[model samples]
Target: MKSRKFYISVFILFLSVFSVFGQTRKQLEEQRKKLNYEIKQVNSLLFKEKKKVNNALEDLNDLNRKISIRAKLIATINSEARILSKEIRVNETELKELRKKLADLKEDYADMIFKSYKSKSQQSRMMFLLSSQNFHQAYKRLEYMKQYTDFRKKQGEEIVHHSNEVQAVNDSLLVQKALKDKLIVSEKDQKKEIEVDKKHQEKLLATIKKKESSYKRELQSKVKAEKRVTAQIDRKIREEIERANRIAREKLKNAPTKPKSVKKNEFILSPEAKALATKFELNKGKLPWPVSEGIVVRKFGKQPHPSFPGITVNGTGLHIVTKQGQDAQAIFNGSVLNVLVSADGRKNVLIQHGNYISSYNNLEKTYVKKGDTVVTGQKIGQIFTDKVSKKTKLIFVLFKNTTRLNPSSWILRR
Candidate 1:
């Protein structure tokens, strides 16, 4: 009986440990799968475009971090699974021993009940009393009777206790079975995740192979063309600023008494332009795309040479590639400041909004003339598609006063 009680206590402790480990394994598996899914999503975003290649690198770094976390989680789960397996074995062994003990307890209880029935008659009680010769012997016999009854009660209690223990062992077995099922499912999911990770790695490799050569040459050519266009636009913007300053100076000189508050060096913005810039800034995220449904091919800033060693490309704004025959639209309501016709016969449109200006280059035909008031989303010109590549690209730029600013910063992050 003492050994049985000890085994029961140990079995309960083992069950408690098993339950905790199973729950931990389940939680860890869920976290691992979630991390794997996030990695897959980031990988997809990385290969969508050339301009976002750097973003992809950041995503890759993020994936690596997640993978590291997953590895730790997997190790933890494995350890828990091993612990559960061992505990399950222990439970099975304890259950077999408990069953054997319960059977022996049941036999002992049945024998006590059978013997009590056999000795229940009045004749048997008289014989038992007569067997005592003296009064002290009779008293001792009465005490012995009470002890026998108590022994029978104790045997019954032991049988009940053993029955309860058997039920507990059965419950533990059920729980262990459930834990085993969960572990199997988790292992299957882990294998699937590993397969997905391998596929993503292959995809990344393929992307590099397909893009490395042509992407390099294309990036170089685009960089050179962008630099030339930026220089031209900068020169034109400087010229416009000088012309405006000259006009302002003349107007100041002609005026009898200029306001004391207005400085000669300061270039005051027209009310209309100020209002337009304010409106544009107010609709930051809601700004219209320069060309509808186009993908940004070139981004703002200096980029490494794609093909040549130690070569680099610089961009002042963004270049969008769109379908053929797409019209470049005004992102905001503004007046056309200049219609540029480059020496190479390319057309560009410059729109002014207060002290800010936006330029759309690589256009084939202009729909809005210089000084024309264009509303937001209004078509300004049709974009010129490169015949060789069959790609319609528009060079879009923004400037504050005469200083160039990154268009990407002004546009929505998405």
Candidate 2:
């Protein structure tokens, strides 16, 4: 009867541990699989294109990204192994304790049966009860027999319950061992991948060192192109702000009902524009990507260049690089302001979002024209691809009135 309580406690403990440890490891394994798939994509799409162009710097960057992801996958595998080890140890202990308890319960049940068999005759039971000095004592004796019978039945049930528990724990232990073995194999594979990437990075560095001057010149040209586009974006935003303010001032002067003053760097906004601005602000950090599939090669703000010790790249927006022929989409609903072209003939489409503006540039061809309204994910243009470098990159910018904002902060991270 006492062993029954112990069996219930063991089952409850198993459930609690399974809920925490088992579920967490399961989620980790799923995440590891997704990371592996992304790494595979990098290998096929990014690294496999080096034969067509001599982009040693870009190649190194891709290799570094894969190495980082491999390290994270290995770390997750190690965590799963540790969690499985803990669960296995607890299960083994529980199994051993249940076996001992089952044996003790069976022994007590057999002894009770042996004694009861000797008093099985009705005459013996009657005499035993009659030997009590009073009616109350006789009633107490009958109650004792009933209690003993209930204890025997409970002992038999506890033995069966604990036997099943022991078997279940043994089975679970086998599963834990299998999972550990699989993780061990995965960890070893990732380690080999990291070693391979390190060799590739070293080779790319040597290649870069051989053509240092030419590489620096190429970097300078790229930086100049980006600066040119950013200047155009800022100029366009300021012009639009001035134009809207001028219109608002004219309306206020001619209204005759109520003349009002207009503020600098402010645009005349309609009720619909005001509502859109509020909704856009509320959706910050949750906005969809401009490109369906792309990776950010250059982030916003000034950061030190990877090759040059003191050289820094001043960035005004996110530079998303994708495969050739990929289309650039609008991140939010807006009307196109202008589709400006650079001196080199690359096109950029500017879209107005209420009092804000977003620019998608470095496009070879644009689909949307001036004064056309566009919704989220609408195709704005096809991104430009450099024939020499075989790179398709886009420069995206945002402006509130005349002040520039980081486009990366408003969009989803991945």
Candidate 3:
């Protein structure tokens, strides 16, 4: 029983080790695949068009994104290689143990066979049994002989099993070693590519620095435009919140049982809306992207301006760079609260999911209008591609009532 327990424990340990390595390796491979896809998208979308206009800032942004993704890919490859190394080591250890166990079992079986051969004669076996003191003793001797034979057969079977295990472990080691080598080679190639991109990026930066005054003026204008759009959106959201709260309060005032005072600045949701909000909250970090395929060029919050050094730009939302003509889709089931036009004539659509509102800005045209219900992944508008810059970007924003939320944290990571 103790031997059986020990073998069971060893088997469990073997399974657990392989299981962990397999899961980690699978995840790394998936991450690497995603990064590779993003790289291809960046090249296809950003580099396909010949530069009709010379915009060093735009080029630098695209190159920076490519470099960032390449770096991630290298890191994932490194992790995969590490996992493979660990797996190979573990397999080697298991193989060694299996080999030793097989040898021990073979030796034990051989000794048993030798002893059995010494009593090969049936007549000698009968005589030995007859020499027992009584019938019960003879029966006991016969039972012992039968159990010994069964045990010897089992030992032979165990030897065969252990031998197979050793072979399997050896094969696994070979596969893992090959994979690790491949991953290492991939990592090196990615590093080289990133280095090349970095050099190109530096050249672009230097060129932009030569025209620092002009670029800084362009950045200032860009910042002002972003701020104007942010203010318009904020005003619209506040108006909607106030209007919704007023209606909710009126309804409660007419009711026989007066509830606690509702917050004037927040949305007073109905029961259905409350349920929807709960579901939306539960799905945080799992919301679909505003666009089907895109890379986030600008994240939420303040960061140094990409074009000009020593200048900070406050980004209220995510700027997702995508292919031209890509449709902006609703991230969840919601009603279109409003559709506002930016100063540049580009359109923006706002969808309300309970108390949470998501806005898609920089659209060429909007398909949904106010009060229109839209489901998850529903096409709401076409993303705008700047003719001069040749960049297609969607500015996506998320909010809980009037409070801003980072869209990246809420949306699923690509």
Candidate 4:
């Protein structure tokens, strides 16, 4: 009984290890799928053949993004390969042990069968029982014979079970080895693609360097525009917060209850608004994308300019590039705080989820107006496609009242 319990414990431990391995393998597969999809989106949206004009900066940036994702995909494949290698090794060891165990069981069973054959005659077994000195001795001899027969039968069954286990482990080892080989091949292909993209990136960089002055001027103008848009967004959000607070204060003055102290820059929330805010917070890292399908071309925070050394580009939000004519969607349930129009006629729609806000920018038309309630995945407006660059990009930003948050950290990875 103790031996059986020991075997069961070992089997459970083995299963748990494989369970963790399977989960990790599944996660890596998901990451690979997402990376592949993003790469396809980048190629289809940014590298269209109809984009006749040569924009060196944009081209370089797009190539860089592609190379980066390919590298990540390769890394993911490598990780999966490592896992497969480990599994294969473990399976091989188990197969060896199982085969040895099966061999031992067969040998022992053969020995038992040989002894049983030697005492095959029923008359010989009866004579041995009759040779006992007393009735009790004869009874003991009979019971011993019965137990020997049962033991032999059990030995045969164990041999069969061990043989089957050996076969199963051998088959598992073959599958793991094949998967490892496939991953190795995939990693090689990704490396080759990265090499080609790097060459193209070099050419784009050289072209930019040749016309350095013009490139610098273009970069400065773009940077100035980014700052202007950021300022507009900040002002609008601040104004919204102030407006909400003012309304809350007005209601308090007319009511019998004492007014609660409020912060100057933050929102004062009612019970319902507070609940909505809590829900939004709980759903962090699970929010949907502003567009159904898009690639983040520019991320939030500060990074050195890809074209020029020393100069840095500060981004206040994520710039996601998608197919032309794609409509922007609300990531969560919210009310439209305001529709902001920039000097270039591009519109930005801001939606408020209690104190949390999501902003979608670079739209040519607006579908929902201020004070309109929007549900998750609701289409708010159409994304503006640049005629010159031929890029359709949406700038998405998130905030907690007056605090800026990284959109990447909040949105779903895919």
Per-candidate TM-score against the hidden true structure: 0.48, 0.81, 0.82, 0.86
**By lDDT, is 1 or 2 better?**
2
* Candidate 3 residue-wise lDDT, 219-257, digit = tens: 789889878778888998899888878787788888887
For residues 326-411, what per-residue lDDT tens digits would candidate 2 score against the true structure?
Answer: 99999899899788888889998988888778889899999989989999999999999887667788888777767778988899
Scored by Cα lDDT, where does model 4 land? 0.83
lDDT per prediction? Answer: 0.68, 0.78, 0.82, 0.83
- Of 2 and 4, which scores higher on lDDT? 4
Task: Give residue 250's lDDT in candidate 1 (0 to 100).
Answer: 73
Q: Pick the candidate with the highest TM-score.
A: 4
| By TM-score: ranked, best first | 4, 3, 2, 1
Model 1 clashing residue pairs (backbone): 273-354
Q: Model 4 over residues 1-414: C-alpha lDDT tens digits? A: 122332353345434434333448879888788888888888899887467587887887788777767766776787778787877888888888888888888888888787777877545888989899999999999999999989988888888888888888888888888888888988898889988886787677678768888888888898898887788789878988998888888877878776667777788888788899999999999988999888888889998876566678987889898999999999999899899988889999999998999999999999999999999999999999988889999999899988899999999977
Q: State which candidate, 1 or 3, has the greater TM-score.
A: 3
Lowest lDDT sum, 10 consecutive residues, model 1, at 52-61
Write the residue-wise lDDT of candidate 1 on 1-414 in tens digits: 122332353345434434434456567557546545544443333223334124222233333333443444455456567767877888889889999998988888788788778787545866898888999999999999999989888888888888898899889888877977776777677657645654554454345446556655665676687678778888887777667667755766767766244333233555565687898788766677787665565587777532234667676679776767889999888888789998778899999876678899989999988789988889999999765445577989888777778887677654
Measured on C-alpha atoms, candidate 1 has an lDDT of 0.68
Error of 1 at 412 (Å): 3.5
Q: Order the candidate numbers by lDDT, best to worst.
A: 4, 3, 2, 1
Q: Clash number for model 2?
A: 0
